[model samples]
Target: MMHAVVVFETLWGNTEQLAREVAAGLGLESTDVVDAVSAPAMLEDDVDLLVVGGPTHAFSMSTDKTREAAQQQGAENIPRRGIREWIASLASPGRDIRVATFDTRVTSPRLPGSAAKKAMKRLVALGFRPAAKPHTFGVHGYSGPVADGELERARRWGEELAATR
Candidate 1:
């Protein structure tokens, strides 16, 4: 059986919500969601793909403050984590896993593409082959309802990844 894991850092639950949508599209019978902060290193075991995401803050991945703001808004912080911390905790053996990245951001109607360059770089350093290009979902300001169609886009991305796997 193929195994996949979706890990993310979210603020105001927008990215987290997107993560769930991606997972649903993957349609895996066995899957797990872990907070980027407190997730264990062992979660990397034997996974076929790893889906990682975070809110885009200052044109980069979400920081510790991002998670904090989300929690401050009443979303429970599941161990208060960040990608840096998560990277520090990863076990060495799973470096061969495939990976794709996603981020939540405000779609600057004027800008050409979503700001996800850093996300792609991080995944490459972690040894994940992109199952698909890194994607970005739009948010309104700091928190988000998610711009129209972002969720659908995420679902499609998920399906495509699963098909390739």
Candidate 2:
């Protein structure tokens, strides 16, 4: 079985729930789901895959300013640091480690950018290999219960990611 770690940042819990579902699909016995703020700066030697995700904000990944704005909009448990900051802190793994990324965005008024795409590029720059293309999961609104069926899609995506390894 492949060992995987899923790191994520969530403003209103939609992304976090998706992260958990992804981990479950990857096989809970061998996967760990962690909030970005608490995620490790470097992967363990035995880890085969790293999955990262967060909510899309202002067309891409969340920043401190955006997180603060979310808090003002009644979002609770906003992370002190978001995916961008956490990714900035990552240490190069020094060997090939597969990675996949995902993001949650509003379902309406199709967005122009993706946090997942941006994150995938950064991780690749840091020496992690892409296991698959970046993916986006939809939510009903800014603060949403995720769009119907997205959770299952995320799970299937996770399974597909595992198969790629």
Candidate 3:
């Protein structure tokens, strides 16, 4: 069996729910998903795959400023540094570790960026191997019930990612 760890950050819980769906697709128990704020500073050495995700803020990963803004606007349990910080907190694992990234964003057709793409870049720069292209799930708005069937799509993506690994 593959050992995978999924870590994610969410302001409105959309991303967290996606994380669980991905984990299920990866054949992992719900306990394998960890919130970014509470994620271990270092990833476990034994994990075969590492999955990271979060909500896109300002077209990219959430920043300290964005997180703060969310908290001030009545968003509860906002994490200080989210996925961007959690990715930074990790040490180079030396051996190649398969990784996949995803993000949730508003459904504006004009929106031109994704945090998942940025996260995938950072993971590669940090020496992890990308198992597949980064992916995004759309929300109807800032606080969202994810677009119809997105959770199922995310799960399929997760399964495909495992197949590639």
Every model's Cα RMSD, please?
A: 3.1, 0.9, 1.7
The alpha-carbon root-mean-square deviation between model 2 and the true structure, to one decimal in Å, is 0.9
- Whichever of 1 and 3 has more TM-score, that candidate is 3
TM-score of 1: 0.81
Mind giving the per-residue lDDT tens digits that candidate 1 earns over 35-83? 6865677654668888888876655655567557656767564346566
TM-score of each: 0.81, 0.97, 0.92
- Taking the tens digit of each residue's C-alpha lDDT, what string does model 2 give over 1-165? 678999999989999999998888886468988999999888889899999999999999998888899899999888988899999999998998999999999999888899999999999999999999999999988899999999999999888988786
Runs in model 3 deviating more than 4 A are 28-31
lDDT of each: 0.72, 0.92, 0.85
lDDT value, residue 22 of candidate 2: 89
Span of 10 residues, lowest total lDDT, candidate 1: 107-116
Which TM-score value belongs to model 2?
0.97
Evaluation by lDDT, superior candidate among 1 and 2: 2
Descending-TM-score candidate ranking:
2, 3, 1
